[model samples]
Target: MTSIWDPIRIGRMALAHRFAMAPMTRSRAQADGAPGPLAAEYYAQRAGFGLIITEGVQPSDDGQGYLNTPGIYTEAHVAGWRRVTDAVHARGGHLFMQLMHAGRMAHPDNTPHHRQPVAPSAIAPGQTMFTAAGLQEIPEPRALSTDEVEATVRDFVHAARQAIAAGADGVEIHAANGYLIQQFFASNANRRTDRYGGPIENRMRFAIEVARAVSEAIGPERTGLRISPGSTLGGIDEGPEGPALYRRLVPALAELDLAYLHVAQGGNEALLGEIRRLWPNALLVARGGRPLERAAADVEAGLADVAPVARWALANPDFVERYRRGAPLNEADPATFYGGGAHGYTDYPTFGRALVAA
Candidate 1:
């Protein structure tokens, strides 16, 4: 029986446990798109997890979607992240920065430049996003030209290199959650006739190109990707071809021999099974809002090599310790989840510390 406490290898990085900390947008970055001052403490506190996947970090200025989310394209951004990476490494933990491009989900008011959001097409997601003022409607996005699309690939490559330079163990391309890459994958979100759109292969071209460029820039051993199959978030409609699209995409990613493929399970058991079968390398599955025992069962049954825990990891910094001792967990407060100070960020006490205080 392979318990979640057992060690595992994902690419060149060896994890101390099978529990990985999934990326969650905390909106705690500086106003200039740099990581907040307490970012290091926040991640370091959760170092008990086998791997720490940082929140969605924009690859370029136009990638900004929500206010105070971090960016990885600037010197200041690199400096800000260095503090985080150093803190995690000192605690003997591995960290992967998730490179995310917001695409059509972005609001101009949320970004520093107030520039129009870009997507695969001009269609809007028909959703609201949090801005400086408050929640506002998502406006129609400008479609990227062929040349611009190629340029965006380079932007992801640049961000991957920056993450490595800042002392990160690796980078995970954020292809999930109806973001830029998922926008290209969804049929309704992408209705172009160019080589980068149309058929499943064409729709997958942008994601493959971005992956290839990032893998080439920073060795494949230091790269990973996160994908959400059949998700309807951000108004994405992959239509009836959703499963078929992933069947093609997963194998293509496996051919690159990248670090790992993280699947955010969205109630598609058949597609999830096929993804696990097609992927020859390490596969990580995330079952949102599920108990830790379910994650253990998945790994024990060989359904997944690793399992990512989100909410529990957020509220319990000493999640591994709590699970080990069967200790009570602190409930996560939704009110303080985003754009907060240390009160909700780094103030989560460890099991031993909490007991002492009690």
Candidate 2:
């Protein structure tokens, strides 16, 4: 049986266990899009995980969606993240920074410059996003020109290099959750007739180019990509061709021999099985809303190389220790899941501390 505590290796990075902390958007950055002061302590607290994937970090100023989300495109951002990586490394933890480009999902009110968000087409997602004034409807985004699209790919490459400079072990491209990359994939969001929007191959061009550029800038062994096929989040409509699209996308990514492929499972066992078969190496599955036991079963059954957990990792800093000891876990409070101070972010008590108090 493959225990969750068993050591594993993904590409060039060696992990102490078969479990990882999934990338989650916490909206805890500073006003300037730099990581908050408590970011180091917050991540260091959860160093017990085999790998710690940081929250969604924008690749450029215009990529920001929610208020106070971090960015890796600036010097200050790199400095702030250096502290986080240093803290995690001191405790023998590996870290991967997730690079996200929000595209049409962004609200101008949430950005410091208040610039209009850009996407593959000039369509709005018909969804609401949290801003300084609270939840507001997303506005129609500006469609990127071919030149601009190329620039955005460069931006991802630059951000990947910055992540490595900031002491991160690798970078996970956030092509999931209806972000910029997914926007190009979904037919409802992308109406362009150009090479970027017509066919499934055209729609996948941006994501593939971005991945290739990032991998070239910072070795393929240090690059990871996260995707959620057929996800309806953020008003995405990939149409019925979603599975076929991923069938083409996954293998192209696999050929790059990237660090790992992180798939956010959406209850499609057949699709997941196909992806697993296509890419037999370094697969990390994120089964949200499922029990840790299921994740464990996945590893034991050789269905997944590792399982990424979000809520449990958030509430239990020493999650692996607690699971090993069979101790009860602290429930994550939804109210404090996003922007907030250390209360719910870093105050979750470890089992040893709880026992000490008892």
Q: Which structure among the candidates has the greatest lDDT?
A: 1
* True lDDT of residue 58, candidate 2: 95
What are the root-mean-square deviations of the candidates from the true structure over C-alphas? Answer: 0.9, 1.0
lDDT of 2 by residue, 1-358 (tens): 7777778888787888898999988889998888999999989988889699999999998888888899999999999999999999999898999999999999999887899999999999999988878889999999999999999999999999999999999999999989999999999999998899989999999999999999999999899999999898889999999999999999999888898999998878899989999995789988878875575877877778898989999899998888887789889999999988998998999998888888
- Write the residue-wise lDDT of candidate 1 on 171-287 in tens digits: 999999999999999989999989989999999999999999999999999999999998898999889999999999999998899999999999989888888899998889988
Report backbone clashes per prediction. Answer: 0, 0
lDDT of 1 at 306: 90
Instruction: Rate residue 91 of model 2 by lDDT.
Output: 90
* CA lDDT of each prediction against the hidden true structure: 0.92, 0.91
Q: Give the TM-score of each candidate.
A: 0.98, 0.98
Badly placed stretches (over 4 Å) of model 1 are: none
